[model samples]
Target: MGKFGIAFTIAILMVACKEDPSAKEESKQGFRMTDEERNATPQVQKQPEKNFRTFTNLADTTFIRLADFSDGFAYDLRYATENNFLKEKVYDCAECYTRVKTAKALLMANKEFEKYGVRIKFFDCYRPNSVQYKMWAIVPNPQYVANPKKGSIHNKGGAVDITLETLDGKELDMGTDFDFFGKRAYHDMTELPRKILENRKLLKETMEKHGFWSTRTEWWHYNLSGAHKDKVANFKWECE
Candidate 1:
């Protein structure tokens, strides 16, 4: 081998070592990347997993957060803020929880409501028994607040205060806001606009069909069937 042969071999090696962006791009389409090409590429950061929790091994009466099981429902949670009739915040944070059975019923009810292009928007769910005492301290009247000593179905984790809202999140007019104490909020009230009456009827019938019963005076309130049998719970949720 002469200097010409060695120089020609060196020239061939130099040509092979040169990078070609167009060739790399073409190979990327076929995913036939060399180790060097792969090392040079930026890695795609993986997205965070969604926090869609589950109810496996949970008891039907066990209280659990509704948002963990599904993201279908909306929440207003007025008591967590000063937006309620009590004119004060009662909860440390806004969260909705209910017994597994009640949560199952609500999931079904919301699915049915989706056919009507709406879903359940919760005002409250599974009030801590201590919160009941707080509410009673504020109202101190059986006409408005349930007796904390007896405890309402909410304390038992089988009651939810909810209203229907469009999928876009607009609330249906039920003639009155949540916590209204007058006859206007009554399920039996007939003086409301026809649209309001129809909205209440839809909410009531759907809930009742899914193992819930409504209160005569509070259209937003619904108690799961046999929920009165559960002991009132005083456990409070941790807030972040």
Candidate 2:
């Protein structure tokens, strides 16, 4: 073949070898969206679960790094910085660790949220018991912080402090910020603005449907059903 013909052929082959953008988008949103997502014209199709760690063959009792399994969710991880109510960096690094069951439920819930152009953005997850001690030392109040002696669901890798954010990372207002201790942060605070109420409702209803129960005091806190029975864990995640 002439040089011109060979070059043209090579260009066509390169085009065919290019990766599929839509498929990448699917990974960014985890696999499969709900029927609502499909009816709303989901941007990508659900591919087989291979690229990340799957719950298959794993013990639901095991703790796992959530971000290691999916990149779809956003993370603020306040305790890793001095930005939280503690005002001290309790965690050595920012990470979201949770039991297998909680992580699976979160993934399923996120898929539903994605259907509406939003995803779960976590402020905290699966806190080490040591950090709980640190928080208690600072606050030492039963109304605000759970007693490290009894250990909260967070110490068991079952609870997560999260909020909803758009796919592009714009946070949905829920009347207050993370660790906000007041009536305004209460789930039953109906005096909030209509938009804030709707945002909280979306978060609460979706999380509840996924087997999570919200605490009355903190709108962002959700505990997985049956997880309170798990032993409190103190292992910390490794920093990269």
Candidate 3:
């Protein structure tokens, strides 16, 4: 073949070898699109593989990272930083873990919350018993922090501290921040603005419908029914 002909053939082969962008998008969203549609739609960047873990064959009481099972939820994880009520960084890394049963309940509750245009945004979940001690040392008040010797439902992997946020990540007004430790944060606090009360009611009622109950004093805290029966656990997650 002449040099011109050989160069033309090589260019065609290179084009055929290139990966299809639509195929990558299809794998991420589980929907296929034609070339024209792909060109018109905006691209969504994929999150890291750590968020895609599965729960196959996992036991109901076994602890699993919540992010691995769903992308619909958001996390703030205040204890991983010094921003919490304790004003101390108690965790080496920010991670949300819960028992399989509790995670299942949360997934269902979040779906319901989505109908109202909001979803669960977690502050804490499945805290280690060791970390509970750190919190107790700072704020020994049982009204604020559970006694480490008694071990809270969080240590049992059945409780979560969460709030609601819009699908686009705007936080719903729930009257007070996480761990406010005041009457203003109470579930029975009705003196707040109409919007704040409604937001708290939505969170509390939906969680109860999913077999979780809220403490009267903490609007952001929820415990799965009977989760306190589970033993206190000191299982710590590995930090990268």
RMSD of 3: 12.1
User: Which residue pairs collide, candidate 2?
Assistant: none
Instruction: Please list the residue runs of candidate 2 whose C-alpha ends up more than 4 Å from where it truly belongs after superposition.
Output: 1-50
Count clashing pairs, candidate 3. Answer: 0
User: Please, what are the lDDT tens digits per residue for candidate 3 over residues 58-96?
Assistant: 999999988879999999999999998788999999999
lDDT of 2 by residue, 1-240 (tens): 999999999999999999898778878988857678678953797798657777888899899999779999999999989998888998999989999999999999999999999999999999889888999999999888889999999999999999999998899999999999889999999998999999999999999999999999999999999999999999787888
Q: What's the ranking of the predictions by TM-score, best on top?
A: 1, 3, 2
Model 1, TM vs. native: 0.80
lDDT of 2: 0.93
Clashes of each: 0, 0, 0
Query: What digit string (tens of lDDT, one per residue) describes model 1 on residues 1-240?
Result: 999999999999999999898778877897666779878969899999778877789889888989999999999999999999999999999999899999989999999999999999999999998999999999999988889999999999999999999999899999998998889999999998999999999999999999999899999999999999999899889899
